[model samples]
Target chain A: MSEPNIYQPFLMRIDKITEEAPLVKTFKLVFVNDEEGKKFQFKAGQFGEYSVFGEGECTLCIASPPTRPGYIECTFRQAGRVTGALAGKEEGEIIGFRGPYGNTFPLEQWQGKNLLFIAGGIALPPLRCVIWNALDLRDRFKEITVIYGARSVADLVYKQELEEWAKRGDLKILTTVDPGGETPDWKGEIGFVPAVLEKADPICENTVALVCGPPIMIKLTLPVLAKLGFSPENTFTTLENRMKCGIGKCGHCMVGKYFVCKDGPVFTLAQLNQLPPEY
Target chain B: MIIEKKLLKQDSVEKLFAKLKADGRRILAPKAQGDEIFFEQVASASEMAKDYIQTTLSPKGAVFPRVEALFRYQMEGKDVKIENNSEPQPTVIFGLRPCDAASFAILNSVFSWDYQDSQFKSRLAQTAAITVSCSRADEYCFCTSVGGSPGDTKGSDILLTRIGSGDYLAEILTEKGKAMVTLAPELFAEAPSEDKEKYLAKVPVKFDLKKLTEKLPEAFNNNELWMEQSLRCLGCGACAFVCPACVCFDIQDESKRESGVRLRCWDSCGFSLFTAHTSGHNPRPVQSQRWRQRVMHKFSYFNDRQKYLGCVGCGRCSRKCPADMNLLEHLKAIAEAR
Candidate 1:
């Protein structure tokens, strides 16, 4: 690891922009360096600080699979100054990017074990990086299951990826949408992620569950996993809060004693349980 | 080790000021700007405010500026060109209080510990601190409670205390301070018989430093005390910003079009965004939890990691605090708690 202060940030030209939902969009960026195509790397679940010049900076998780190098993709929602400006950007536009900051999920530790991936709403983007990495290297794991949800059918992201993964036939992909909405014309379940997890009755033995999404979804889903006999240690999740620097130095992104950017972007539920009940 | 004396009449002091300015060294002293005290570069010793409390911003800014360019860069066809930004000018900070002097010592740990930050280190190497003892303390001052005192002179090269009319007793504690005295030893006058009495009476011993340090570890596990103590704190982090010992910062890259520069800026933990994640989950969402983090990080975590207390007991946070959260009261509560 090189010294953190030696981190050099440069403008990455936006090669393409894909609208994932009404609010979420993915920006594919190629670094200013020609050699960037070969060396740009990030682990699954790690994030970066993206800047829109005069708009300031915001933390955005690298959503594209790490194995798929060259272009780094960040999926963002138009919530604040930088993200709103980033959402308004078009193809070939320039955006500032730094990092691959923070710790990533321990994928190597999960090899040969059954994996359960749970995500909700826009949270799917960061988890998708891991999901795709797992699928690409399918033989390394025993079984792969993805449980995902959104507010409505329209709120769901990566519809095309869902179709492709469903066709894979080697893994299980479960999806749900919140109540009080027009149901999609599909052959899948519809309910909150926690309720779906209880109904799906995922096997807890020899398995690890990776959960991500809104706080409400996680708050409700954790107990359901526990009820299904998954210990806190066997569960993992990625949490987000508003951030300026994606490094531990910035005072804001703390979860008790932990610096979310440094100590975790990924944490076991056992570790999460130790935190003050604020998250 | 204490140098006790009275100021010489006009000629000796004038020679001291002459040597300081003749060398092109920037000497920053405190000045009364309306209701606030601020450190400004002085051309002569006459410009220094003899009586002033802590400044609105600490002398930390003189070393680590609010905004500084790490490097300049330009974008070419496929590669970015970069240039190293050189060090700033050498400076001597005059008239720092003990709390302020001690904060620099705390800052030294953070910048030099894990990875050497040359940007801050270069400034520390070039800058020297001249501390002045406080004759009277305000409600916002608790330096003695946090391993410091009104007369604690560990961080300063040259420590001064007022003894008589138009006179100062200077203690040359370090080689850097000895160099200054060597340059102008003619400024020194013979000590008066009553100099020791004036030194003790003028600079009052305020708090028991040893008792406070002993009580800190016992206070660490008192969660109820911390919870109630931090109850009113809005968790805005204004306290940390105003504190002399709070050295946390955030590094950000600001770029325009094709190129940009990475900047380091002051940051605090009270803000919700400070710990927020991109995944729309925050571990410290409420005021209680955030407040706990502030106290625990300073008192427990930093001590565990660096073997030093994170605070210097400066009540500047309590003085400038918007919410009126008094750290002195909290410390006392922790000290007395079961």
Candidate 2:
């Protein structure tokens, strides 16, 4: 085998940063070397480690679906050191990034089946990648229902993108918040993600439910999906954990014997059930 | 032939060390400092800690470094430039014990199994281990219970036993070890026929390896007992860190502006985030559940998947554990329980 040192490192420059919400923002990155940029590859559910040089490093899932190329997106909240440093970054700034690592969402398995997307708060970013990937390949699936909500109207992310998907002729989109407020324009459901999912009454047969959000929302949604006749095999979800390394070697992101970066950032309910009940 | 205690002079050992250095091979041996011992790169035999017991840190740091570079990268206009990692140099680790050597075997199973970890594989290919047989066992050591003995050659290229004060008998177990000794044949005194019998007399534990291996299957799915056993662990990861067989790692990309390098570092299972999700869900939130996973992986799951035991029973965990949780006591409890 060739010496590992012979392989050059991967570099990416931050082109833009958009404030998705008060606590969340998305950074647009492009490779420094044009040839290396073309060689850059990643799957939908894969993530990358972004670094703030002297401060430290943090892991973020690739927020953009594989359907889109050239530019990559990483959405993160203002937490911890590196993330806080990243939050301080402005447009056209330079940062370090490597990967398109981890297993992507199982798009092949969901092809020709109905896709039910359930998301909560800012957790919608990673799921958004799948939503766009499915929509781009709309002919392959039966139906798409997106149920998303957060603390309030201001807390909802990708409102413009959601508006675009809602405008499409063949999609059902429902919006909600935990507590309704004085905002007179609010018209969607006002409850938790699980409650909203039940009210939507998605068909479980020949369908796969893709869920993401806070831990409490996920805990509440699993039973609801089972109640709606979705087998453990038919339900899927993405995972986020405090990760120091985006690879399996760093012991931070493991669930039983499975490493989230390698075995999955995306998993079916059946696989999740088999894992140790830590996350 | 066994040399009398008086005949084993320090000068003869120095000549062997000088010969190895002249051949451009690095020889590492244990060094004694008061009550603590450590493996240091050696210049001569005088630097070796032949009389010392266990070191504070396992010699694993020599093979799989505590910190290693994976790759380097730089950024330009929404693009990334990545450079691959560099390979390490070749070296032999001398005087490793059976427990430490067996840890390499356990590590090999994980690094080489599913997706071959090139970083680990490359270093392993160029390395050799020379293990010394235990003349006196420690209070914490229980290698006999975990498919290893003080004289097992599972991960050793050469097995050495002291026949007399300074005269050692070496059984060349691998081609690499044969090469190691062939480089300086004048240093090794030819072994006498009775050397094997003298070594076996030092066995400390009457372990039923077959019984322990058989009882492992019955312990699977018994979470309640595991929970009770692991209740006191503070989840500090000290046990995993000190263990010779644990091989979990974390990879990170450390960057400065336009340049960044990927790094692979050691990790432990005792942390809460070992199995946490970014979406705020944690599967092994409780200490009991995490501890169950540790035992299950070592004894049951690894065996079921890889057909290999995940522990070498170096007893470093038992020796270093502040909570005093020992794998041998726990396994014995599980095996003897009704």
Candidate 3:
């Protein structure tokens, strides 16, 4: 058969749904066609356009790692029309998915080096795939540190995964909430992520830092990472822009000459420094 | 490769149009619509505008319409069934100027870039463009500045240059043009071997493209210049709608209960809502920033990707702009920026 049209989406059924946080849900989707499911492969940091049949499509990074096959997972918060419709969907419901688009994180370059993942709020989904991928291939890397923060303790996603990482003897996981966001029984750090990151002080020597968050969080976190002696070339982040066509035909998600949908959703800080700050 | 040249009498041009229509080809040509000339469906050659300098809108809509249904979908229990739209029919676009023809080549680069849009590709494959060499130009005409001319046949299937009062010099460019000739071989004759450049319009170079390319990146951080220049701009998006090379689009679904159709509609970066995120954060929060994006996308970003300027110097944006936000003036300002 001829190649399917670029716009036509593959039917995917939601096998499982987990309430990651307030207004946020993680969906485990399996391709309805077994042939398509066997043929699909994507690395960490690549995204897909998920559609809610009658609503519209939204771009989201595949939250599940490639090591786990048969199904792909995505985490999304109730934000707009499409996400709202997706929030209303139940298990066994089918949605449209098109992708595995854009560039992947350069994990091979960070082999044998310490890996530090820093994410804020709902932005953790983009980094979760990489975190698990590195953990799955544990012997290849030196040390793993995850510093994730959210607006409040209730807003933190992947709670079960966070507990599992915290219990692991080989990795260091630091979770935090914003100032005044902690309850009376809170055990994690209580401060802004950038400030807590400075206090945690993961050694910058031969370490790769992956950071993803809101624009303001990213803007403030980069300077702190620079101050902590993290090389801009080794520091990476993924940008989220409003997109229509995830394959770069639509011109909404451009940062300078780069299309976020094609050239990158993942970029090194050194590369981001060269681009215009429009994203 | 040597290009074959032929001649067609003005009276016999109507016969070629009749023959094309008889073959069930849709003829899209520049026709008068109230006060403005637009590229609309024409039945005969006489219905086409005879004295228009340029069409108000470019012929880009022939392949990429303003709004088109991508696919229709209906819910079947828990499953959704999608039906693709029918492929476009063969078409012939007559009376397009050389600048407008060149714009098609620029649009092709974006549409065929990472993801091949089947709707646009199918329509473009079946469409034949017949460009007419310009005999007159206005102050807004600056095709010569951007590596195009009044007689350029870069994206045309057939180029017609008026050689005399009742005759035209035809240069068949592609296989489609050759096929059109086979339809009415009796009307086309051997060219007379004369200078056709004398009859073409005179469009002067307004700015240095090399200098503009170099200075545009530096001007990206100069908010004062962009803000001052775009202070009078009203964000109506008319410029983007009229521009042939502006290919930004939005995908939306219109559903009624159990069934719906997804549509791809024309969108513009000049508008404030083009890049606004769902979380109430807008990257381009002001009109100046949006205007800067439009200028930089055409002058800088496109050159980086395709090694060609997105603007074909067609001047449709300037002509259709509600406010006097002239593209040539901004480009010249960028070229002359320190």
Candidate 4:
């Protein structure tokens, strides 16, 4: 292969776009070159720098699971300049993507153990990758519990996937909306994810908890997990930082000594405790 | 291995410039401009500033420019065309101080860490550095504290030390230096064995690097100290802009209706926007936190990750800081903290 140009992005066409929630959309991207698609490989919890041609790039996790190949999916809210441009784009439009960067969740280590997924609001996308990855390899895991929450009933992403997961008899899935967020007809739980998790009271033994959410949610839930007898070593969460150049060189995504884009985006609670809380 | 040494008459320095220019190499030399010295393209030796402690900016711009276009793209109907900028031309930077020269190596660790920055790589490959040893020291100079010296030859292709009023001892350290020598062989003569240190500057070590390294990590949570120290900081980013080792950058796209170019510009950790997330959350939310990041990144974090000190003890940041925030003073305070 020729020398790799670090900043040059691979062209990916948006095959489909889903309005997962208000202001949040999921883009199903396929590589413009079929050969590139075949070679592209990413594990759960890894992120990529996605760009609009005339706009800039932003870091987002590969929302789609690796078990399903041929295309990658990313869910982003219309927050900033790049995401606004990304939100404005239609299907069949070409955008730039570079990555499969950072370390992945140690899924093999969780084999034969129960898996608990805790996420909030737009943060579901990062955990969704790991959730589907474990579900696809169903035999390797025992009981799977998913606790997801959003600001309101309308704010939850992947509604179809939530319904499908709830219907599965093998897994226990609980969805929640914050207090005062539920509609009169809303049937799911009403409260925060951490509070709802405490009520569910899943067995902490032989289980790994994967949590992703807003920083506030993560800060609150981590303590609850400790109270519920989940070891810090077995609890993992991915960090989000403002980044340019998904590789390590750019230097903006650093949290303490660690480059969030390289050393992590994924870190266990045990690992996080050792690091400075700058993130 | 024995290194070759030669002498060049100070007056004949112009002849060396003539030869370098004739060979089609762009010569970047420190020149006196208004109140400060700046590294600018020079046509002749007389244009160079003869007396200056240090330039306003580091010579990093020669390799990693302030603004660089990665590629230009144009939309041709539904298809897009990309044209990468050409590689840099062979260039020579003359009169760079030893500390600034050493910074190139420190910066190399970051640029080539995981993703190779080809633009920076090509510029570094094509450029040759000629470092002049400091003959006088300033209060802000502390090269010795950070594993460097006034006459350190860590990153220079050629090391030049003034031996007398009109004579310089030239030690060619790299093949590029030897090639420059070959360009004008007659200008160089055999140097008599003499002590060159007599003419060099003496810079005192201000702080204990070993002690500071051990204490800096513990200082991360000392928010009150950081807040007190950074109270006067305006967050103008002057220190980072003038620093030789500060390598943070921002990438942007400039476009018209159908065409645009992706440009990378120098960024600073001192800026509040540096770590601001799109969701209106900032990891380093306060000036004190940002200040802590600068100190921790340089003295602790960078060493842990890159196996080298991010700072070269050039003291340019201290000199350029408008808030009078001195790195040496801060480091001393950090060392003295319980």
Top-DockQ candidate index: 3
Per-residue CA lDDT of model 3 for B1-338, tens digit only, reads 11689998999889999999888899999999898999999888899888888899999999889998888899999988989878687899999998888887788888887677778888888899999999999988888988999999889999999986659999999888999999999999998898789999999899999999989888999999899888988988998998888989999989998999888999999888899999988889999999999999988889999777888888888887778778898889889877
Model 1 DockQ class: acceptable
Off by over 4 Å in 2: A1-9, B1-12, B68-87, B114-116, B201-228, B231-236, B250-265, B271-286
Q: What lDDT is reached at residue B275 by model 1?
A: 58
Tell me the DockQ of each model, to 2 decimals: 0.24, 0.28, 0.65, 0.61
Query: How far is B85's C-alpha from truth in model 2 (Å)?
Result: 6.6
State the displacement of the C-alpha of residue A226, model 3, in Å, after optimal TM-score superposition.
2.0
Question: All candidates' TM-scores?
Answer: 0.85, 0.88, 0.97, 0.97
Model 3: lDDT equals 0.90
Q: What is the TM-score of chain A alone in each candidate?
A: 0.94, 0.94, 0.98, 0.98
Q: Rate the local accuracy (lDDT) of all candidates.
A: 0.74, 0.74, 0.90, 0.90
Please state the interface RMSD for every predicted structure, separated by commas.
Answer: 4.7, 4.7, 1.9, 1.9
Give residue A193's error in model 3 in angstroms.
1.3
TM-score for candidate 2: 0.88
How high is the lDDT of residue B40 in model 2?
A: 80
Docking level for model 3: medium
Model 4: what TM-score? 0.97
